[model samples]
Target chain A: NAGVTQTPKFRVLKTGQSMTLLCAQDMNHEYMYWYRQDPGMGLRLIHYSVGEGTTAKGEVPDGYNVSRLKKQNFLLGLESAAPSQTSVYFCASSYLTPSGGRQVEQFFGPGTRLTVL
Target chain B: GIQVEQSPPDLILQEGANSTLRCNFSDSVNNLQWFHQNPWGQLINLFYIPSGTKQNGRLSATTVATERYSLLYISSSQTTDSGVYFCAVGDYNQGGKLIFGQGTELSVKP
Candidate 1:
């Protein structure tokens, strides 16, 4: 299994440009998340999905959107890129119970280095 | 909202040395994890310790849920152990949302 794979390992975008980051997990996980890591800062959640058709905003959900149409794929979209959005983006997935009781370990993908100019 | 804090933002040690990294959370957590992010930015899961202690090779972790803190120990450090160590906590009541600490950067020199 690839665990988690992210496309476009690296990218540079001009200001106001838009793009979507694709995250795929072969672990058959039920939970997926998008997070951004800035220099000297902790990873902040951008968005997450509990299941195939459910999505929710996280700590730093502003300036970003997400969609989880399939159980294995989670996509993060930037409507208009900004310099502040430039950071290493990581995609993670886990298996959790439907009632939100037990927590599972998260498997993270090799991050994508994004530069917004 | 939950707060996660890691101590010794930067640590420098020589080969074969041992060190401890700490994480303190603001509230009770259902899941506490330790992750190592290599220089290439790939995060590797080290442990999922919410309570008690667990050891793997030269690395071990302990989480005291009542005190809302966790510790990760690295023994006989190697260059491969050099990277940023992050402590993340998941709130079960909040639908398994993970909050991370700023991470402790460790530099092991041979």
Candidate 2:
């Protein structure tokens, strides 16, 4: 099974342009996250979803928006791309058990490289 | 927000040598994981050691929850191991919202 997959492996956009990154997981995980990796910096959470139809902002969510309308899909939208937004994006998913037990391991997607010019 | 820190921000090792990476957190956590970002920018899960020790082939990890620190050990390093290693922590009540360390950049030579 494809654990986690992200669309648009690479993209380049002019300033003020808009784009959406899609993430899908086949693991039936209840949690999904969007993160961006910058040079010499750790991956920072952009947005996350605890379950279907629920979304929350994370560490860096200023210029981004997220939607988790379906259990298996999470979408990240950049309404106005900026040069500062150029970075590799990663999507991850994890399962949460009924008794409050949660999966510690987060399976990550291959990543999408976005370049804002 | 919990703070995560990693030591030896940069490391260089010869093939066959061994090395250790350390991660310290500021608060209690229910889950801790290590990830390796290859040169191609793919993050591969390495370990999920909230406490105790777990070994997987040449890689092993140990976490001491009481001290809020975790360690990753790589035995017989390979050139393929050259990349950035990150330590992420999931807080006690945060539902999988992981906070990450800056990461230790490792370079293994042939």
The Cα local distance difference test for each model comes to 0.92, 0.93
lDDT of 1 at A52: 97
Lowest summed lDDT window (length 10), candidate 2 chain B? B90-99
Error of 1 at B98 (Å): 1.1
lDDT by residue (tens digit), candidate 1, B1-110: 78999999999999999999999999988888899988988899999998999999999999999999999999999999999999999875565778999999999999
Which candidate number would show the highest lDDT if scored against the true structure? 2
Task: List TM-score per model, in order.
Answer: 0.97, 0.97
Interface C-alpha RMSD per candidate, 1 decimal: 1.0, 1.4
B33-75: candidate 2 lDDT, tens digit per residue? 9999999999999998889999999999999999999999999
lDDT per residue as tens, model 2, A2-115:
889999999999999999999999989999999998989999999998889999989999999999999999999999999999999999999876675665578899999999
Global fold similarity of model 1 (TM-score): 0.97
lDDT score for residue A14 of model 2: 100
Pull out the clashing pairs in model 2: none
True contacts kept of 2: 0.75
Candidate 1 lDDT, A16-52, residue by residue in tens: 9999999999988988999999998879888999889
Q: For candidate 1, what's the TM-score of chain A, rounded to 2 decimals?
A: 0.95
